[model samples]
Target: MRRSRLGRFGSRLQSRSWPRFVPRFVPRFLRCLWPDTLFGRLVMILAIGMFAGQVLTSTIWFDTHESRTLEVPARLFASRLADTARLIALAPDDAARRALAQQLGDPKYQIAWIAAKAPGVDATSTAGFRREPIVQRVIGDLIRGVLARRLGAPPEIRLLEANVHDDSGKRGGILNLFDSPMPTGDFHVQLKLHGTGWSGWLDVRANEGQADALTEPHSLALDYLVRIYLIRFTAVCVLAFIAVRFAVQPLRQLAKAAEALGRNIHRPPLPVTGPSEVRSAAQSFNAMQQQLADSIAQRTRFLTAVSHDLRSPLTRLRLRAEMLPDPVWRERLRGDLDEMEAMVTSTLDAVQGIEITETRHEIDLDSMLEGLAQDLREAGHAVSIAGRAGRPVPGYPRNLKRCLQNLLDNAVRYGERADVQITDTGRSVRIVISDRGPGIADAALRERVFEPYVRLASKEGTGLGLTISRSIAAAHGGTLTLENRAERGLDAVLSLPRED
Candidate 1:
């Protein structure tokens, strides 16, 4: 029970700590292993697939073709050497033996007599990544078996050069090619006669010049192996890259069109081309854009008409209130009439501001802010502007200026002072407008304050200022948000995306 409790406690502790530790560690490794872009990811996948395919192909080829081709020559050479030893031993004299040796010498196997002891055998040196010692061992075993059957005992044998050797008559460790059209080498052996002092060296090579279908050594050539893999892998990689690029082109165009539409709702619809899926997406996007434009137009016209129709009655009511006999009643009616008129005007202005048709241009926001600050200071408000955007942003000059003006007005009215700062992040610009004032008590009410006509108890505006300002910022592919400062006051942050 105690162990179980301990285990449970440990698990609970680990679970609590998991989030903090895993986020920092896992993402670094994931970033290193994973490709960042679509193109890179596709290429990486293709490379891995190609490598696996090559590995499988090499395994199959070596198992079936290479092993069979090399083994046949070793077996045949062993048999021939055994036959020659038998014939030389059967010959009556030296002259007769010499003649028999000459007769037995064929294009594939050559016999030469040598008077010396058998050379030392180094088994380990005979086999490696590039050398096959098993081939020589099999051949030696076959020769010894044949001699044992004929002579009643195995003859003394030494492997002078049982493995593949270059044209220079030396064992060329690895990656050495014999001078020929196809990679060729000699399989040689030297053995001593039982009673005679003479030792015979039997030289067996892979069939003269033309490698037969069964005995071809072309597969073993270093150049042939390298060229086949290099050329094949390179071609596969290029083809895979082209195929993947073509497949993702439609998606790239769709993303670009979406970004552009965000900047300007009036931008042209995407071209409905390419594959069936892409065409369907483009058609849907076009329909949605059309619907949104129609809805905005209809809403704008409704607001304009409502504002116009309400003005006549509001004017009449104001005039009638002024003529009232009771002083208190007359003043109260006049104030109500004035408030109604202000609401109508504010609504009309907000609607008009959002439906701006100003052309986009590269404007230096830093200069504009400085000029606006100077104007505000001239109007007897304390305004301080700090920090400047490094690059000009693409936007409507009039609408953007109006948006900034509303924010500055709000700051001065509520906080009594405006502090503005701008930061450029290459792709976007952030403008922070802060004021030292009584901030919103409820954090939830901060977002609700942007709603039209929803003024705070202490504020006296139509409350459409923030609503219109945010709309303008959004129309230019940006955002406007408000946050309560830790000390006192509210911070209004505006982010505008820069045109590349």
Candidate 2:
């Protein structure tokens, strides 16, 4: 039981701390490699997949083609050399030997003769083909095995020169073989005939051009590289970006709609367009918005009706209080009725404030604040205005005025004075109303005051002022917050987003 408890505790700890822990633990370089946006990450993923596929394809194809390229030429060259040696051994006379060499000779291979004492080099001669140790060794091994079987003895082989020419007087089937159909740099090999005091030379040339990338050095490597790395890879990235952009467009629209709905739940329904999944999401979001608007409307109607019905009863109570015989009793009952009426009126106002029916328009916030300050000053309240918004802000002017007026009233009533300042950023606007009076003692109660009927103990008037102000601010996609001043009093800040 204890072990299980420990496990559960560990799981909860990890779950709670995972978001904070991951960034510190993961390598910074790896984190930097990833892009922040969804589109960039999607493109990166697709590019990686394409690169991997290309590498795999190149590896497999090169392996298969390279084997055939190397071994096929080596095997064919060895077999033809063996056949030449065998025919020379079977010749009955010198004349017949010469004819055999000529008849057996072909475009890729040339038959020839070399004197035993000819002023020429052999396989031990260190030049060209001999300089390439691996190539020489492999060639020697392949030809020797075939020649030894045909000649019934280990044949003496010599790689005279990689590119031999016919400056010598000796002439034969392979003499002046430059005129023959072999490649220019054909390699020469001399095989010793034991019984005969002569040596036979074979000019072996590779029949095919270097075609495989693995076995042969590629001349077009740069071209292939440019085509694959620059052209093909770039094309793939561009296609992926375009495809992902289209895919994410609907998501962007959904997010924008959601933001607008937060400011005003009565926003028009979203269009059911785009792909099937996106259309479905849009339809569902539209339905949710409609449902929320309808619910708020229903509640507002109920509150309005209740307030109206209660007003009639309150009026009758006022009349009955006026008819009371004792003056003190009548005064007390009237006070009670007045309080009841004020509470009902405040509640209804709060409800109606949320159901804004005003059309939006551009209003000069600076002018509005100036007018408010002037009005308060004329009404014998200590109010001053400072700062200016250089531009107009988009909102319902009446609602915004009401929101500011409420805050100003609170500041004047409790704090004894009001200081209003308007700050306008192109994207948003902020109005700060400050006062020098005893702020709420309890920090927790600052937010609670925005709830219906909630008020500070010393403050008089309906508690719905802050609530109604906040509802108006929210309706305009704004916020209202209260903060205690460092020295004394409170600061009520109203922030609203500006129209694009």
Most accurate candidate by TM-score:
2
lDDT of each: 0.73, 0.71
Measured with C-alpha atoms, the lDDT of residue 28 in candidate 2 is 62
Candidate 1 global TM-score: 0.59
lDDT for position 212 in model 1: 55
Name model 1 segments beyond 4 Å from true: 1-231, 271-280, 424-428, 451-453, 483-488
For residue 223, what is the lDDT in candidate 2? 57
Model 2's alpha-carbon lDDT is 0.71
Highest lDDT scorer: 1
lDDT of 1 at 428: 95
Q: Write the per-residue lDDT of candidate 1 for residues 213-306, one digit (tens) a residue.
A: 3323465564556766877788888888898889888888888888767656677789999889999999999999899878888998899899
Q: Return the TM-score for each candidate structure.
A: 0.59, 0.66
Give per-candidate clash totals: 0, 2
